[model samples]
Target: TNTTKELTYSEAMYLCGYLNGAKKENRDLTITEREIRRRRSAVLKRVQRIGIDTTDWGAVNAFFLDVRIAGKKFRELDGEELLLLIPKLESILKKKEDGGY
Candidate 1:
């Protein structure tokens, strides 16, 4: 059986944050939990990069937790999770560039 899993909005946002942080920090494909928390600011940068204004950090934080990416807070995700998230983030960025966002 072939089943496709769809990511929720919060999950997508979390992945976007991770991707932006990784790119900004020039780090390896996988990062530690401490790094993820430290790099939460990257999420705002990424949203701005996509031409979206982020004046609501509270909402962003809530969304991150709602998605359960790092449980209660941004933390280290497994390498396997990062691998899956990277492609999704790339796709979102491409879509934004294509004016699909």
Candidate 2:
């Protein structure tokens, strides 16, 4: 049997914050911003529950969390815009968690 749990919006939010902080605070962090986003998306895609579309929602949540955590505010971006940001966020999150960053 397979068991799965969807990430809470807050969990995703925490991850996004973690990713952003890791990048900003860890200059010695070797991972590229591009790679970080990619890894983050991979994690989100792994989610089996919650959100209408895990991949899309993950990306949007990531971008919003990053922007908000960074203390930079901007106009609302459409889903497509957020989708475009997933890979970047994924890579960052992965590297940081893996200790590559």
Candidate 3:
């Protein structure tokens, strides 16, 4: 339950660079950091709305959070980490739900 794989700092930097490039390469498009953050917030809210009862939902949401921050071109993510992390997230969510630490 403790072996959740997270993106390394280098990987995260690479992803952010790619995202910046993508935004700049758009000829007829404009994007802002505010827009990205707003989208990320929306995704976070949707994940919470899944009710925290199912392991799968928690796993999906955690992965989704990584995706949001990593700028969506994360080729290294294999989705298997979600299978490993769901139980831990479930417990955390349960504690948060029940007013426990």
**Top-scoring candidate (TM-score):** 1
Supply the global lDDT for candidate 2. 0.48
Per-residue lDDT, model 3, residue 37, is: 47
Strongest candidate by lDDT: 1
Q: What's the TM for model 1?
A: 0.34
Comparing candidate 1 with candidate 3, which one achieves the higher TM-score? 1
lDDT of 2 by residue, 1-101 (tens): 13224667776666676867854446445444445555445434532222225546555445455653222221344334446545555566577668785
Q: Estimate each model's TM-score.
A: 0.34, 0.27, 0.27
For each candidate in the order shown, give its overall lDDT on alpha carbons.
0.52, 0.48, 0.47
Residue 81 CA displacement from its true place in model 3, Å: 0.3
RMSD of 3: 17.8
Give per-residue CA lDDT, model 1, range 1-101, as digits (tens).
13224777776776777867745354443456455544444544553465544566555445345553334323344444444444455566788889896
Model 2 regions more than 4 Å off:
1-75
Tell me the deviation in Å of residue 32 in model 2: 32
**Runs off by more than 4 Å, candidate 1:** 1-73
